[model samples]
Target chain A: MSATEEQVDHIKQAVERWNAGPVAKLLAKFPEQRAKFVTASDRQVERLYAPEAATIDRYAEKLGLPGEYPFTRGVQPTMYRGRFWTMRQYAGFATAEESNQRYRYLLEQGTTGLSVAFDLPTQIGYDSDDPMAAGEVGKVGVAIDSLADMETLLDGIPLDRISTSMTINATAAVLLAMYIAVGEKQGVPPEKLNGTIQNDILKEYIARGTYRFPPGPSLRLISDIFAYCTEKVPNFNTISISGYHIREAGSTAAQEIGFTLADAICYVDTALQAGLKVDDFAPRLAFFFAAHSDLFEEAAKFRAARRLYARIMKERFGAVNPKSLMLRFHTQTGGVTLTAQQPDNNVVRVTIQALAAVLGGTQSLHTNSKDEAMALPTEESVTVALRTQQLIAYESGVTNTVDPLAGSFYVEKLTDDLEVEAEGIIKLIDARGGMVAAIEQGFVQKQIEESAYRYGQSIDNGERVIVGVNKFTGDEPPTINLFEVPESTTQRQLDKLRGVRASRDVARVEAALAAVKQAAVGSENLMPPILAAVRAYATVGEICSTLAGVFGEFSESTN
Target chain B: MNAAVKPRILIGKPGLDGHDRGAKYVAQILRDAGFEVIYTGIRRSPEQIVDTAVQEDVAAIGLSLLSGAHLALFTRVLELLHDRGADDIVVFGGGTIPPKDIPRLKEMGVAEVFTPGTPARQIVAAIDDCLLHHSVM
Candidate 1:
């Protein structure tokens, strides 16, 4: 990319001459569609990017070779040529038996990994029969209240052969404990357990809002899992520090990177303070991002995120391991972008977002089904969603090479600009004394809320076009089959829960529960007692209630 | 309801799921439109919402839920409002609800149901209209 002074001068003069002659003449007649162009993130995009007047000097430092330091190109040198990104459809609903059927069907359809979406009751640590769980059992996802349910959930699936990712926080310890016990029953040892848990709690407080215990005990639980996983479940990923929810909450692409990494930095800082080595747990830490339809900005945002996180780990935390510096992530198409109107159009939206994720070099992907905005995607739409990824991988030529858009002048400029933008946000967060303090002071929530308001306003005033919503008109209400979670699911799950309670060793359960609370009160790693409790068939509600007594619940500090 | 005074309303989120962007945005819109708004943060129960509406003596109760439990949760709120002799409080709803259920929700005594893609001005106008025409008002 090096050029002599004469070459630069010639390029600049040629551009000026053409703009004055042809460009000026065309502008007087044809004209452009809009006065100014902007990305979905509101970044003002230039008509064209040129090296004649732009900064593209630091090639080696800023955009290194794939798999090298500051991995702005791609995390893997071979990229998809080595293997396509894991096609994981995050599916779970109804009873464990029903969800198990879905998982086996997906695996048969060639999904490489399994992602379990627990019901709201399970996510918030309520058993099926609990009063708070009324009318909500198995509504959004599969319900797992004890080791028995986890066993049924993973019934015929071989643990050692497949990687499972459970999207559970707040009660992540209890769920992971259940998962481990299930693995043991299948003759798969802890070391052979390959999977991830969305154990991130910061985003729960900031965006997702599934938090249970307060910040103190929440951080303590996360650190304990990190330490335990590094030792016993050596192949397991302990966390997926998520920005998917943050973006769903309407933050721009920049805030997605800024706030996610700030939360990550706090997690690392917390773990280190608990006496864990950075290299040990940092390698297993993962990220989750939403793939919005802003093609170039979405691609560049991923590149910028990789570079920013790498630099943060190496320079800020003094890390030496290369794996610790690499930013590995899972991408799910943005759920918020799917419009309930003209649900079929969502198929097209998911396709473009999926392409951006692939071009950005994601490690794994979950394409939101077209009908998700209305309800949980039906089986047919879920198949089409999975086929979207399959089409891009097998037909689209973009994944034939690594980081195909790496050298484009526009993408490179965006990469640099986005990195700078995110860093500025992180700096503001640090000025408020790190992420925990910022979240406690409601700074993080306020930033997201403002961005969300602006985004909503744009849609309302026709500044933003959501096809079938703001622009395209429909004369009559359209009817499409919506997936309904049968109310019988609650009754079925409650019966199973009652049976488990009637059959399990009551005395052993009490002992394990006491041990869990003792460990929670003291400074011991909580994984052991939690595993014991799960193995003894203690319900999720029982274990969580014990911890809640010690660590109290975290209520929103409303502004 | 008088032409000079905008009715007060309590916007509440009642469910396990915490998708609150819509709830917060509506609260902001109503507040800006000269209405007194109390936003019950995420994860409130129907009892809490009904109790708040009674205590605040608001003209309307706006509920939001994205967890697909809206039909049951909103029904519970309407039932509680009826039992408390506060059935005069206009109950309105919004979330990821489908059009097929809109009639059912309206028949359940929810004064209005706003789905996705609703304009801010329309929400403020609808609530104002709902309050101005109420029999108790």
Candidate 2:
């Protein structure tokens, strides 16, 4: 993608003619809108992007055809043309029954997949009745205490017909086990089940503070799930290495890409060290990312990530499987970019970011509602968010072709720059002894914090314009109904948890818990015992506590 | 606030949510504004936050909660402060709190509530103004 001598001369003559004529004339009359224009990541946008900007030696090698190695253009040869990206909305709050209703409603509304949001307690493996779960139960997402709760959560949903993505990390194994058990009850074998688990824990240590066990046992648990799922549940994505949380916590676009893949490398290395073949488990590995408002940067971020990851798997790990080289990912519109000042403006913002994700060729997508800046979105807002995706898919016509923005000079330059910049970041993290050691040494945190602080300073100094906040200010009170979880949700969940505890066989639960403890003590795959305990109706708190006894909990420096 | 005293403040995260960007930013700004700030990080209980405010002998406490559990968590923190005989410690807050809930939170002894997008200068000025009125001495 380089400029030939004739093409360079053509652009040079045309630019010189314009600059000397109309450009100078306009400059004397009126200046540009701002002194400088920058992208969301603060990269200066060139006034003119030409062929020289994209100087590729061989397009076939560097930017290969879709579905080939170095898939800079796209992962799928026929992306949304064959089938539109799966529209999965992340929704869950209150009790299992309530969340089930939401899921059914979403399915009825034509949502292709389900993404469950677990409450803080459920995420950290605390049952509803635990002391630490007092006020937080069901506040953020649905509270699933045991298999009973999971069963109710999936009440009438056809497991074989739909795919589900669970945003669970520290207790991903237990949650996945519960999901498998639910499939079993529905007469659908584990191999027939299709879904993904946010089984990534390194991102938890680096960005989100939701880790239960330390890194040693955490990676062991991850590899165990990897091996288990490969053998039993072939359709499920074993781990979704997430950059969404990292970007939400205020890392720049390149940092988000670098840190996420760094963590992925750590996981792959750990799985290899555990004596698993690269092709055996690498194909099931998926990624999750955030699509911010920067149009080309966000899109290029996805492209760069795919190319970089393809290289890593093929070159670094010697992965032979074609599926293993494809960096399949799900994307969500950036939550941090939503403004609380003019909440309705978020719809436009989300629309833009969602378009970026689609144009970048996401496998699955979630668009945030307008009201998320102030509260969990109401059903009305959720509908609007879903419709936004439908508009992009059907009405917008971007899905007519794969990688619609692939060959644009600006986009190709951005893709290359992002790849180089993110590779530099990865090299730095590798020098720090990989992601785990970097997170432990607080190097990654410090970098993110500094970026966040600078971003704040920019917004404060009006270097960046947040509509309805720094510019076009308004004080209008929000008339949109804020989605509120019932104050009694905690009590209702506690009651359900207590009833399950009372009705379940006490001795059976105890034996299952003891078996989990034994597995944790030894080098056994913790999945079987954990699944048994989950199926036996032992609470999440019980299983996590049993594991905690063997593997100590993680507490951050919290500086 | 006596300009000489450099009024101490504790910014506590009082919920299961670990979104600490706001809490951390506010703490950094307050510290830069010459207030001695103590940040008890994420997943802090009401009891832990109240005990830290009392133990640190801070003149004010700023609680940040984004999990929509602010109503329950803030009430409990205020109750604990009262129970610990530390009610004089001014407690302000911030997070994803709605405007309608601001009055309710203030009525619960929360001195002020800063929602998302509040500027650093405004937060520091408000804290300084509140500490001046609710003097530690």
List, residue by residue over B1-137, the lDDT tens digit for candidate 2. Answer: 45457878999988788888788788888877788889997888898888888888999999998888899899999999888888888999999987788999988899999988888889888888887787635
| DockQ of every predicted complex | 0.69, 0.69
Model 1 backbone overlap count:
0
- lDDT by residue for model 2 (A1-559), tens: 3356567669878988888899889988998888898888878887777765234446776788888888877888888999999999999999999999999999989899999999999999888888888788898899999999999999999899899999999999999999999999999999999999999999887777778999999999999999999999999999999999999888999999999999999999999999999999999999999999998899999999999999999989999999999999999999999888879899999999999999888999999999987888888899999999999999999999888898788888898888888989999999999888999999998888778887888898899999888889976766778988987888888888889988999999999999999999999899999999998999899999999999998887765
Residue B129 C-alpha lDDT in model 2? 82
TM-score of model 2 vs. true structure:
0.97
Q: Which 10 consecutive positions of candidate 1 chain A have the poorest summed lDDT?
A: A48-57
Q: Model 1 off-target regions past 4 Å?
A: A1-21, A52-56, B1-4, B135-137
Stretches > 4 Å off in candidate 2: A1-6, A9-29, A53-56, B1-4
